[model samples]
Target: MFLAWNEIKRNKLKFSLIIGVLVMISYLLFLLSGLASGLMNMNREGIDKWQADAIVLNKDANQTVEQSLFNKEDVSNSLKKQTTLKQSGVIISNGTHEENALLFGVTDKSFLVPKMIEGKKFHKDNEVIADESLKDKGFKLGDKLSLSQSDEKLKIVGFSESAKYNASPVLFSNNNTIQKLNPSLSSDKTNAVVVKDANWQKKSLPNNLEAIKIENFIKNLPGYQAQNLTLNFMIIFLLVISATVIGIFLYVITLQKTNLFGVLKAQGFTNGYLAKVVLSQTFIIALIGTLIGLILTIITSAFLPSVVPIKFSIVTLTIYGVVLIAVSLIGSLFSILTIRKVDPLKAIG
Candidate 1:
């Protein structure tokens, strides 16, 4: 470790340049990871807020909540206790302020509803609770929003954090209001039912209904599965590229110090000691780079435009940083092998 520190102190510029490169790459990786997590939350936060174990949908709907239809009778007859039925649909706002929004028709006291961050839950017909993201679109508590398809105006009664569905801000309304908005939908029918207990797989389901785990249900959301897979592949690809870059950098650095390594061997330094120096140097570099990257990521996330959804979790960042250091250490193994191969006589000649 002393040897590694002395070497780094002697060649500060070279090591600093490598550290800068690592910082940039790690920052990019963390940024992408944050975006991926934010997108996932946007896609499923509404469902996640439900905190339900299983979701029941019409099997004929092919695992899509919007296409599924079940009524109170179906829930009472087929679903176990602690179930909440919710109707969901995509509706456009009226006029020039037009935007697609996910409308969730939920019972006032249902566990499926998100806790209000501001104001109170819906208590009257046409009253609604919306995601905080809607605030960016000029929506506020007590504001009246008109649906494009229906003349009925909804009064925003509350706002909640992180209540989004399929990349659209979610609004919770009374089942009666949703039925009024969409006359085609039966008064008793809901898009899906959230089940809390009982093994859905073990229990017999109704003829047309299927129970899917919450994770699987989230995957079935439009573009969710594909988007996650693509982003995850990109993250993996970037990690591999980062490892290669580190490996090549360390290998080149080791090559430049070949004579020094040979002289150290001639002075009775063990191969294990030299290997330790190289790994210690790698660890120091990785730690510094990762810290810089993390700080930059946090700053960037703080200043990012609301238009760009980016979620940062400390746990996720820590995991990524650890993995990065591990990869960098693996990359340094090449230097260790080069150290082992250094011939003591080569330095004397």
Candidate 2:
């Protein structure tokens, strides 16, 4: 390690280039991870707000809440106490301006409604509380927003934070309001029944309905699985490339220092001693590169606009940082093996 430290200090610019490559790879990995996490949250923000124990969906709907339909009376009969929801995708218009929104129908006492950031929560059907993003689109409290393809108009009674679903702003109202907006969903048919029973996940019920864990339900949300799959693949690919590049960089440096290693070997430097030189250099480079990368990611997120889906989770970032450094060290094994093959006399000749 002493020899390794001396060489790195003497050739700072060359080592800097090695660190630069890792910095870029690690930056991309962390940035993508943050974006992936952020986008997943955006997809199920409202669902998470519920802190729901389980969701009971129609068996024929294949676990998708949006597709599942149940009659309130039927669900009411099966579960002693439950909150019913009717979700529909629709457009809201203020005549000149329109925005895509999810219309959510919940009973008067349903706990699915998020705490308000401003104004008051809806206490009746057709009166609604919306995600604050709608305010940016020129909506204000007490404004009437019309439902597309229907005569129904929803009054924006309040604004809530982080109440989006599938990346769309939600209009939280009662079951009758949503039923008015979507013809397919009649007044009697709600999309799903939500219950907080402790053993609901394993509960057997009638009416072709079954309860599922909320985590599983969120994972199955439309577009959630596929989008995460693509981003995760990119993260994994960058990790592999990072390891390979770090290994190659260290290996090339080892080649240029072959004669130096040979001279040290002639002076009775053990193979074990030479190996530590490479290992120590590898650890230092990995640590510095990942730190710089994580910092850059945080700085980049700070400058990004609100609309960009990027959220930094220190825990997730730390996990990735550890992984990057571990793999980089594993990669250094290649250069360590190269050091073992160094010959004293033949190389110094």
Candidate 3:
């Protein structure tokens, strides 16, 4: 350990350069991970909050919620089988504030409606709840918001933190109001029903009806699977890049001190002691780089928009940090092998 520290101190320029490379790699990876998570959040934040067990869609639509249809009789029939049903629909419209918006029509029983961050849930006829982020676009409670797509006017009664399916602020409304706005929909039937059962059998479902768990259903959406796959690949690629950069840096540093390590071995130093030194140096450098990378990620994330959709928990960040440390330890093993090839006699001359 002492020898490793002395060597690093003597080669300050080389060590600093190696450490700088590690810092840059770690920083870039952290940024990519945050962006990937943010993109996914923006794409699915609205649907993710619904604590639903399963969603029913039209079998012919092949997993698209928008294409699924439910008449009142079909919906009522499905509700009788021990599952609560909520009518919901998504319609693109121009908001009163003149922004392109997506209206989320959901009944009072809809699970998504109860997550009110401000104001109240959907009530009163023709009244709707908007996402709080839309307030900056000139929306206010009691103000009339128009759905130009259907030429319907709705009263904004409340606002919440829920964003749209694709970053647009969502407007919550009841089934009747949604049907009235878009008369093509039968008021009796619902778009989908959230089911709560582990033993759900899709085979038993009647023809043209499909039951899917939320996770499976989410992937079936047109761009959902492709988008998630792209982000996941980006995160994995960055992680690999970070590991490779750290490994190369350590390997180069170890190669430069081959003769010095050979002399140390002749002077009664055990390989184990030498290993301790190498590991200590690697760990110290890696810890510093990882810490700096995480700090930079947090600082940058602060300036992003609320609707940009980045969801991360303490557990996720902790796991990422652990993975970084583990990869660095694995990378140090390459240098340990170099120590075995040191010829003590060669250095004595």
In the range 139-221, model 2's lDDT, one tens digit per residue, is 88888887757887789889988688888888888767777777667877878888777766455677587788888988888
List, residue by residue over 168-273, the lDDT tens digit for candidate 1: 8888888888878766456667777788765666767778788899889888888998888888898888788878888899999999988988888898999998
At residue 165, what lDDT does model 3 achieve? Answer: 64
Misplaced by over 4 Å in model 1 are 82-97
Superposed on all Cα atoms, the candidates' RMSDs to the truth, in angstroms, are 2.0, 1.9, 3.0
lDDT of predicted model 3 = 0.69
Among all candidates shown, the one with the greatest lDDT = 2
Positional deviation of residue 271's Cα in model 2 after best superposition, in angstroms: 1.5
Cα lDDT for residue 103, model 1? 82
User: What is the Cα root-mean-square deviation between model 2 and the actual structure?
Assistant: 1.9
Q: What TM value does model 2 have?
A: 0.94
Record all residue pairs in model 1 with backbone atoms less than 3 Å apart, i.e. clashing. Answer: none
Query: What is the Cα-based lDDT of residue 130 in candidate 3?
Result: 82
Residue-wise C-alpha lDDT for candidate 3, range 292-313, written one tens digit per residue = 7778767867786654556555
Q: What is the TM-score of each candidate against the true structure?
A: 0.93, 0.94, 0.86
The 0-to-1 C-alpha lDDT of every candidate, in the order given, reads 0.82, 0.85, 0.69
